[model samples]
Target: MSTATITPKGPGTLRGARLPKWSPYAIAAGSIALAVGIGLAGGLHSRVQWGLIAAILYVVGTYAIATAVEGKRQAKDRIATSLVWVAFLLAVIPLASLVWSTVARGLKVLDVYFLTHSMGVVADTEPGGGIYHAILGTLEQVGLATVIAAPIGVLTAIYLVEYGRGRLSQAITFFVDVMTGIPSIVAGLFILSLMLMFDMQPFGFAGSLALAILMMPVVVRSTEEMLKLVPNELREASLALGVPKWRTILKVVLPTSIGGITTGIMLSIARITGETAPVLLLVWGNAFINANPFEGAQASLPLYIYQQYANSAGSGAAYDRAWAASLTLIAFVMLLNLVARGIARWKAPKTGR
Candidate 1:
């Protein structure tokens, strides 16, 4: 008698075969045919809707049928994976479209003169006007707003996160939420009224104040959340080392949370930087360069875009300037983000400490 040797198959060999790549194509073709049929029956508006219905039905029906053929668990996993990828693509499409549109329109008039010259010489028909004054004004106003807002916002956030525990905290939270919901126009109006009461005409500084009001609540909320994430152990450790409460908060809690607070400040800056209504109500500059924010009028990037686009001349050189100004504003925001990231990286404490 001879002995025979047996070879056992591996576990991977026991797995079910994958569906053919042609399966999705076939499903899509069938879906399109169904969509066309429904569209013809329903006419124009319904026709458009039918295509969406058909696509959704095809995806769901195909998944169900596949699951029935292949086991429940595997089919569910595969379908869920497909849907997730589809959702991601759907989101990216609109974001890509928006960036493309902004870039295309903005590139039309972004030039040296557009950056150097103010709107002084550039007429509705003329094309060589620059946004230098607007750029300067925007920086001044936004900087002043940051100066006014950051201290108040950070302190309020610290109070809420560190010391707030009573009904007063709850009241403050409610009011901050309410302020966050207040429209930019309303803030503008409030600032305008306050100025009028003071018998002072609206100026660039007033616009900064309005923007500060709009920005402060946002900063407070974001910073409060960030500060709340600081470990209580850090505070305890500092206090055990004979540190006073204020010193513990300043040295231990704040240093750890500084990165996040800075990020929130940058975000708030971005939020108020594009506010048109507040600047419009407070600042009134026609074309001249006004460096002074307190006594003189000033123009900002957002106001420049508005003034240009709202002109009697619909699509002219002035409109091109508006587009260019928009691009500059976007560039400014990008720079601020970079600076914030740098600060965060530099100030971040060592990990695993």
Candidate 2:
């Protein structure tokens, strides 16, 4: 007897059609065109409304087309990917618009004269004043705040990660969490209340104190996370070499995590740099330069912008100054971020090649 040979199909035999890589771009372009047509027909004047309509159409159209061509399972996956891209665009568009607006409006009056001179005698309606006073005050207050906050924050983080135990550690963690959620205004108010009790006047140091309050919790949180990332084996190995616990931590733990710690500190500073309410309540914005942070009222970029805009009374010059100051503040924060990234990269521990 002879038996016929039989063959079975492999799992790889089945495959489905896929949309091209350029399909998303085509869909997005079509969605924008349709959205614009709808906006024009409906007499919708707001670009924001047009964008919202476009985003919605893009998501819906992507899913519909995918389902039609590639069945339900593939369509669901495509929908998810499309949603993520839509969300990214939604976030980026506003930020791009804001940066563009600030740059465009700021260039009108931003020049060397504007940078060197303070408000000194310039009237709100007049065009010649600069942010010198605000810049000086910002540097002093932020410097003092960093001095006060960084060590305390780093120490607290060390204790929590290395030495903390029992109810005390829990309490400390609870308070840290509470402080993290406290509003900038509330921190300012807390310091303001202390100043009121002492009958103290507004000064740059007071604003620094409020900023320190905000900075500490962020520093603590970031440092704690970074320290935790340090391998326990490093600590064990150090201890095996007859090193004291504190020395091991200082030499091994901190160095290993220093890059992350520095980045976090810089980010925390950036967070506080934009605060207006705290500085307004504590620093009591000054029109002229005040070099002394501890003794007298001082200005900050946020306060300067607010005062310029509020006191403008429809003055074009004041509006221009406000926009220029905003641009400068943005540049400062961006620089800090760049520096932080650079430091992190430079100090990052080398691994196997």
Candidate 3:
């Protein structure tokens, strides 16, 4: 008599038949290959369309194969997983492409000299021009806005979290809410209206005013949230030690949340630094460096990029300058983020070693 060996199945604790580990990878590869074939055959141009096609094929192929081998439930789970991955790629690819394109085009004109010089006498179509003036204006305007907004925002947050009560507090909160939702254009228009009434001219400080209006709500919201996260035990301990309420808040509460507060302020600064509308409406884009922001029209990086692109008229030089300006602006924002991260790390509450 001939005996046959038995192959044991998976544990009973593990329910349902499962597809092989390599099955999804195989399906994805096949889907990509098929999508490429279809794209070439159908003469489709957009790579985005190809990616979508590949994503669809991958999902469909996974479901069909999984259902055939395992079951409907497993197939549904796999489809969901595939879809999430596809969604992530869809979001990330565009951003990656933008960075790549900007770097590629910006390198042609970006240099130390390009950064240090100004476009004072150079025409828009000229090959040699720099964003020094724009850079200076951005610094002054954003710095001034921060100076105007940060203190008020921090104080308001403190009041809301600590001393606020009843109708007055509610009204302040309500107004802050309304201000937070107000558009940059609306802030610009408000300042513009004031300027129109007083016959004021476009100046960097005017842009700073509009930017301050936009920055305040963000700073307030962020600071309020940070203050709320500070443990009440700290406050109680400070108060129990015969410390005055104001002293306790100043010494204990502020220090504890300083990291987050600083981070939020930096992020707010970053947000306003990129704003073009308010600057365009108020500062009016100057090509020459105006060291005095209070008197005359000023240039900013966003406005510089916009001006270059709009006047490019398909000229390669202008396009390159625009890309370089964009790269510089991105770098500035990235630097702010790095600084915020550094501050957060340095100021974070020390835990048990």
Candidate 4:
């Protein structure tokens, strides 16, 4: 009988490669050490500053350490991971600063009375006013804008994705691309000019019209992307069932794209919510809270911020109110984002159990 030769495979031959036991621990230790080192060295009083320094140091140290341990090929991936974290940290900084600044200043004026009261009785020279009017204007204008833009945007997207392949479609697409970058002031001016031609006086409706224009291209682009993501097989299957094309689109296509469409619409709303020029040039503003968008001047959050800062006396109370209003605006945007996320999650396609 011949003795069979046994051979052992190298560690690299494992189908699922395992990380070295010390690698992660080494990386963590290096990150923590560098973070603490830099943070302490910076001598900053603010916790935000300390956290930022720590984050930056952690990433740099981790990358350097990863490069030493991993071969150059793997080291590139490690460097990329570190860079992504750095980018994430950079984005977080301004968001954190905004929140902190708003909270610190807003706390001085965020009483229950502040939320319910308007600026009607408050003197411009004095302080202790509220943003009830501004809040109402923001809600009505943004709500009306959504109502106006949603149908047009969804239809345009449908046309582009389904029937658009030629010159007309290309023209529409090109215009939409151009409109995406049109200055906010240009939208305001366009609405102003259109209203002037109709001999209509400036009103909240004009502001709403301008906002809708601002919102439309964003909605169209976003909806187009979502519609394009729908598999052609779904469309073919629907047609195979003897369904009308419009019916198939209304049922199968729209339902499949609804989640993303909703997300896009929400984003579009956010995009135009803070627009000041359109509202200022069109609706103007009023101190009293007005529920109707058609009849009178209205004040929104951005306009309110502008008015308070520009018109208010140097009283601490006025400054406090401005900060509080800013906080409320930020809160509204955050809430919308959360709701959009929830809708997207709930409406996501179901897979196998």
Candidate 5:
């Protein structure tokens, strides 16, 4: 252990080496090219197989190059980075393809007339129909479900966060967790059992009830987390100022967490928006317009999409309509997410002067 060996330019001491940032891109390109060549030689027809091969080559190449030039630690870090990028591409490519395909096919018949009119008089095999009835039913049913589920969910969250303790709280928590995983079909069946007991027919309101059941746990969990995030100091300060616990929660706590709660509620609505099984079991889907959700079976977007695809899919008009409806549903969910983001931004606490 001579002091000379520890010096930067001394012999018997290792010199540090590092790869340039562009090394990753270079490696990736080379890996892809090599993979293509290998695939061609091996007679591999699947593009998926080629992509996987390229990813494997990229990761292995990164590790080997980094280990040679840098060290084992840097090599391991590069391997992890490559794996993350691979995972990200795996998640994104399918979604991008789905959106592109939906848009391409849906544009064929997704005009103003298609959106504004209904399939009331149009035959299933005919080339002209619309989703107006389904849209109306969807809006009404989802709106009703939100109204039913949101307040109950918020109240339950409030109770759990502010007042919960002992066996009662544990029971409530247990049930909420259980409900979170309950299948959409089970919720539909539960609502259907009630309808059967009352000897009632399918209606949009029944579908709303089923959707509400599905939305509740999501809302509860999200609201509960938001509530828990509110600072305890605020509660104590309000109580010290002679404010009631209820008033403190209403004024200080709920306001602080309202943005998150609203976002959660919107997300919950989005979650239930695409549920077809519940709507099929409870609403029964009417081709004809049924303006009264309480009186008769009502069409919904999910149900309409399912009916089109199941009954007459890939046949002239039905296939086009199904793609259009799917696009519409995707748009609706996207809009909900956008709205949630907007609301969350609007209601977020202002931090700067």
Candidate 6:
């Protein structure tokens, strides 16, 4: 009876030890302190160097500590995570530094007056002038380029994504890719060559033509990707309801992807906004405000910044103005990005509806 009732004991569970929640923070702090000590001892003056050392130390320390407390598998996982965090911090540090430097240097001269007045009758060495003319030209040139690029780009994208069938589509795609990589200087040169042939002078519209050249490929690529993301089921449903292909595309496909399309267009605009070479070659920077883009040379923000810096010849006033203009350009691009995001959110398709 005893032999019949005998049972084996269950196997005991083996649990690996885990690191505490605060271990990563503790490791990071220690690594930073050690890095600072090493920097001071080694006479390393660069903060970037110190950060790089700290990042290395953190990764190594994490892996070693994790290996001691947990198993090799857990240690490897922590190392991967630590590396990712290190990479993220490395990226963020430079961006933060750039923003900090720009804001600090730009605030010395940036003001309402700086934004509202033009550099009229004021020498680069003088203390007073503004970006009014530059802003006007920038707006006009970018607007004209947008007007030229958006519709053509969108239509090209539609044909490629919706109706493209053969070698023509493939050739278009290849050319678009080629255009995307063409340098701003090259685009300017191309337009300059055309203008030379026609005996035309530098004007805002000339800059617009170069910018449009740069912008079109970006818009076409973005719109094509967005259109491709529209569900084929939507197209089929519309077709089943006796809707023509064009109407279905206009009503269904476009609405579904309008958010993305608008964001893409805005991003393209931002990309061309900071171009200096094209504007310098085509717009031929003006000191006074010019209202008409077609008739005369215009001053754009990029060209203004460049001209200020180049003509300053170590003048503090011109340098300050350059910094201020840079800040304004950055602000303009940031505003465009914010507006793009807002538009995208507003136009995003509602799943609940």
What's the TM-score of each model vs. the native? 0.84, 0.94, 0.91, 0.84, 0.95, 0.95
What would the TM-score be for candidate 3 when compared with the true structure?
0.91
* lDDT of each residue in 1-353, candidate 4, tens digit only: 01112245458664332236455445556566666666678665776666666566656655555455444666677667767867886798798988899999888888778877899988766777788888888989988988999899999999999989889999999999999999888999998888889887666777888999999999999999999999999999999999999999999999998899999998888888889988888888888988888886887888888788787667666777888988888888888888888898888888859
Instruction: State each model's CA lDDT, in order.
Output: 0.82, 0.92, 0.92, 0.82, 0.92, 0.93
Itemize residue pairs with steric clashes in candidate 5: none
lDDT (10s digit) by residue, model 3, range 1-353: 11122234468745556666777777888899999999999999998788889999998888887776677888899989988988998899989999999899898999998999889998888899899999999999999999999999999999999999999989989999999999998999999999999998999999999999999999999999999999999999999999999999999999999999999999999999999999999999998999899998999999999999999888888889999999999999999999999999999999968
For 1-353, candidate 2 gives per-residue lDDT tens digits of 11112234347856565667678888889999999999999999998899999999998988888876666998899899989998998899889999999999998888888877899899989988999999889888988999999999999999999999999989999999999999999999999999999999999999999999999999999999999999999999999999999999999999999999999999999998998999999999998899999988999999999999999999999999999999989999999999999999988998958
Q: Write the per-residue lDDT of candidate 5 for residues 44-108, one digit (tens) a residue.
A: 99999999999999888888888866779978988999999989998999999999999999999
Q: Which is better, 5 or 6, measured by lDDT? A: 6
10 residues in a row with least lDDT, candidate 1: 1-10
> Which pairs, if any, clash in model 4?
none
Highest lDDT against the true fold, candidate: 6
Mind giving the per-residue lDDT tens digits that candidate 6 earns over 203-321? 99999999999999999999999999999999999999999999999999999999999999999999999999999999999999998999899999999999999999889999999
Between candidates 2 and 6, the one scoring higher on lDDT is 6
- TM-score, candidate number 1: 0.84
The TM-score between candidate 6 and the true structure equals 0.95
User: Residue 13: error of model 5 in Å?
Assistant: 10
Error of 1 at 20 (Å): 7.5
Q: Mark the regions of model 4 whose C-alpha exceeds 4 Å error after superposition.
A: 1-64, 198-200
Off by over 4 Å in 2: 1-12
Candidate 2, after superposition: displacement of residue 232 in Å?
A: 1.4
